[model samples]
Target: MNITKNTTGIESVILTSPDPQAAAAFNEAAFGLGARLQVRAGDAPTSGFRGFTLSLVVPGPSTVDSFFESALAAGATTVKPAKKSFWGYGGVLQAPDGTLWKIATSSKKDSGAATRTVDDFVVLLGVEDVKATKQFYIERGLTVAKSFGSKYVEFAAPAESVKLALYGRRAAAKDAGVAPEGTGSHRVVFGGGLGTFTDPDGFEWETLA
Candidate 1:
């Protein structure tokens, strides 16, 4: 799979699947994100969301409502309906491949103004030890954006690139209201320019060509 981020920091991940064209169309229509899919030369495993989720942060309550409705119209299953939260307005959905997605808006204003597009995109992973995972990414050349002891950590991605974060596994599961049962192949493929490496939590990441 190939993942690219737009100048707006919105990422479009192109992947090889049983039917690339259809897959791409589905993703684009479903999430309003770019995707390029192709039939694979080898067997493809089923996809699932076990240890991680893709987060899309928008500007306001209306945007979240619109996006959530759009996703549902495009065949996404609702994991949670959008609602007010201590953090902000947000909801969850499950793609056809079982990838979990969270759409949210922060309560805090951006630069004292609201953002109209995706404010940030991140691959949030649940880890056994947030502090150790933060250290691991730090040692691998990733800069830190913020960290709260071992409870959570966010990494600085290249401008307009998809960001990464780590959180306590149990906490993450609790936040998602799901049981933490990640195992086997993660189904989702990650490719950027960071080279191929598996995090301590067994989440695989690959560098872009």
Candidate 2:
């Protein structure tokens, strides 16, 4: 076995947009994602929910609002406004590049002040068969950190990189405040530390350089 080969978690994420430069600028302005998140130009036919979401889990409600507002100022359309929920506080938006994003926190109150930092950067893949896809990742050397039957699965990742999760496709769309129907290329890719292969849901993973 090639033990040196990584086949577990994501190292980075790339979004394909019609205007790569504008997309990269939006990311820097809204999230300050730096190099971990990237963009390239590719305008393949895609509409509605693209079967995934990028979420920024922040520290507090204040931080959530900060990111949410920044996204709006960067020309993102609001899918949901920043508001308090039973789980905490958060909001959803679609970037000009056509990527859905959620900025959120578990703290209802302010801890200190808002920052452009993230407590957790999550890539949630909306798959048709969560249980089967979860099993596929397991066989590919991904260790499950959390599992919820056929509904959801989360994989462990290095602390400095992004986290990975799986969710039901339709349910993911509902959470994103969009209709649950889309076709054509997902227009996104993952720089997984793992070697390259496409998942059951058609999400692509590339070997991290």
Candidate 3:
């Protein structure tokens, strides 16, 4: 049986943070993303959800500068002064909601990745109810896998060549060497339409087709 699943290409990563501005700033400098937009409550162009907003992208420095300038005018605050970092290019800004944002160009180490080619990335979701989670994926026409006595399940979509694994929140926390705060503490990679999922404990697996 075809066990591997796939999903539509992930366009970007949405990070949930208490201080999105700081998080965004750190990400830009550390990961090399340019600001895309900074939406705020009431004046926000989207529905639901409130608070500060910021986005980063991977592009040329010039483009990022112009984009960030507009974001600052819209509502974002300047965190660290935007300037060249020791690691090539980097800058920091704050979202109107008090989230910190950072942007920068990819350093050689960041861009010099040696990852294998793949069709798409996968998500490892932490769930309180494993059975219900499995059923949810099943109803969605996804494939599932399990090990004897293992409180974990794997779901894959063949069409998108993407996979999602659900595990007991506690078990996942143990595996990730984290406290399992019931929130996302692991890393979900999204780039080049291919990446892997890394748990808090640093477990990694390729999600390639």
**Candidate 2 versus the native: TM-score?**
0.94
lDDT of 1: 0.67
Q: What local distance difference test score does each model get?
A: 0.67, 0.87, 0.43
Poorest stretch of ten by lDDT in candidate 1: 1-10
Candidate 1 residues 66-101, lDDT tens each? 777777877788888888888988888876556678
What is the C-alpha local distance difference test score of candidate 2?
Answer: 0.87
For 57-158, candidate 2 gives per-residue lDDT tens digits of 999998988888888998999998889999899989999888999888988899798877798999999999998998888788887787778888888776
> Quick one: ranking by TM-score, best first?
2, 1, 3
**Cα-based lDDT at residue 64, candidate 1:** 77
> Model 3: runs farther than 4 Å from truth?
1-13, 28-122, 145-150, 157-162, 181-209
Candidate 1 structure, TM-score to reference: 0.80
Overall local distance difference test of candidate 3: 0.43
Candidate 3, residue 113: CA error in Å?
Answer: 8.8
Highest lDDT against the true fold, candidate: 2
